[model samples]
Target: MKQLTFLLLVLLLPSCSVEDDSAPLFIEPIYVNNPTFKLKLDIIYVLPNEKYAKSKYNIDESKYLDYLNGCFFNRHDIGIVLGESRTLVNPELYDLKDDRGNESAIFERETKGTCKPDRLNMYIIPRTNTIAIAGLGVTQRTLITDEFLFKTTSPHEIGHSLGLHHLDVDGNIMSRVKPYLRKEFNSEQVSELIQQIITINNR
Candidate 1:
């Protein structure tokens, strides 16, 4: 009887460690061998009339780019190239034609074409390659967070550019909101997105 009780306790030990369903998931890191994917950003900022170039974040665009690159590179081993003088289709592009036919009016405004198996998405806005951080109403101060070098909003878009979708798992770069990313994509998502990118690019 004593031995049976001990065995029962041991069996219940793992269950005791089960966390609450509402608790956030703490994910492990995924270290990739430098991204094999070569990415380009034809960024545009139509927010409040093409203000990405003049926004406070743009004071150091390269710094922002580095942060963006690091977030993705650590995930699927991807590199980013900022395209010059490219005309972005603008968020309004979809209103003109909903080829992909996404129901998200907000997403349509925020994202462009996801070409490779829908992995590589183009952000069309403002006409110059950039993402602008703007606030609606009194939410101006809400964007400050450790998840990004500057603002979390830009990285969200960059995550899509790197083939990451908004996974509810906390800490992953593609999380819908903050902490926007626990910093980078974990091993599972990295593999999933890489295969998606490869599938998309090979097409």
Candidate 2:
């Protein structure tokens, strides 16, 4: 009887060890090596009129582009080329109200007839000095961002354009809360993004 009891305990220990090994030990941030694909991003500043041309909330196009390029390089070894920039006067887009949920209508209004299919369009609008929605990604590879948001918001929105969604976990590039605090993508996210880029290039 004593021998049988010892055998049963040894069998249970292996099962318990197997269960423990099932869980992952770590989830390291993902990074790509020698990325082959590159994306051209066009930054568009949407001003209400000439009066607000020197508004403090307006983003410096060159500086913002440099910031985005550095951020992407550090994360996934991806390259983002700074494309053309233009200031458009559209009062309707500047003073648009967000009555509808998701703010898709405002994004549509701001990007309609202004986007190019070959490049990504980033529109910085003077909706408010405060960061309301931070950024909105629309079809045609266009993004409408708030003027007062930080440069980190650019990559966050760009991530959305690449088909990545917000993650529930903190300290991730795709987290919904204070994404500016995190700037790195996990291993899985980087892999998915690379695959997405490959698919787009093939198409």
Candidate 3:
């Protein structure tokens, strides 16, 4: 009877171990050197109405910034510092649509009152009328929905704001697909991104 009990316990242990191993563990990268260039970032959260609640939409800002810093500082000696943040309760701007260049029209309206030329302007929305686009970046401005805040989409749009173009490679930061695998910017992109920052700082 004692031997049978021991055997049953051993069988259960393997199943428990299997369950533990089922989930993949993600280890974040470590950085020892501080970045030389730091860009100022400003965020604006748009709510549909005054009564609408603001949740993270399953993605927190700290985690997104952590991932952004890890990729930029670790590779290119670039980092972002939060400068200003605000919440805009505008129903018209919140319901953004991409119909017939309305995205640009709505973006202009959203930033008209709060535009800061010195810092990177990031607007967070609940969702876009278009489902295919996760975000859009033009020059110094960026618009990202809540659901993609913590994904590689954040960095990808920032790359565009810094003048980096899209790449077909699976692992490049500017890739159009494979968000999980996209990690680092290529050497040319690094140089261009740094140059853009320098130009902006000099201005």
Q: Pick the candidate with the highest TM-score.
A: 3
Local accuracy by lDDT, each model? 0.38, 0.54, 0.64
Answer with 1 or 2, whichever has the higher lDDT.
2
* Candidate 1 segments exceeding 4 Å error: 1-35, 47-59, 74-76, 88-103, 106-149, 160-165, 176-181
- Which 10 consecutive residues of model 3 have the lowest summed lDDT? 10-19
User: What is candidate 1's lDDT per residue for 46-98, written digit by digit as tens?
Assistant: 33335434352243546655655654464557655555423233444323224
Model 2 TM = 0.66
Q: Please provide, for model 3 over 70-128, each residue's C-alpha lDDT reduced to its tens digit, 9 standing for 90 to 100.
A: 75445578877777766778766676654434665566666777757776778888654
lDDT of 3: 0.64
Task: Give per-residue CA lDDT, model 2, range 86-127, as digits (tens).
Answer: 666776666544432435566676577887666667777653
TM-score of each: 0.46, 0.66, 0.73
Which 10 consecutive positions of candidate 1 have the poorest summed lDDT?
A: 10-19
Which has the higher TM-score value, candidate number 2 or candidate number 3? 3
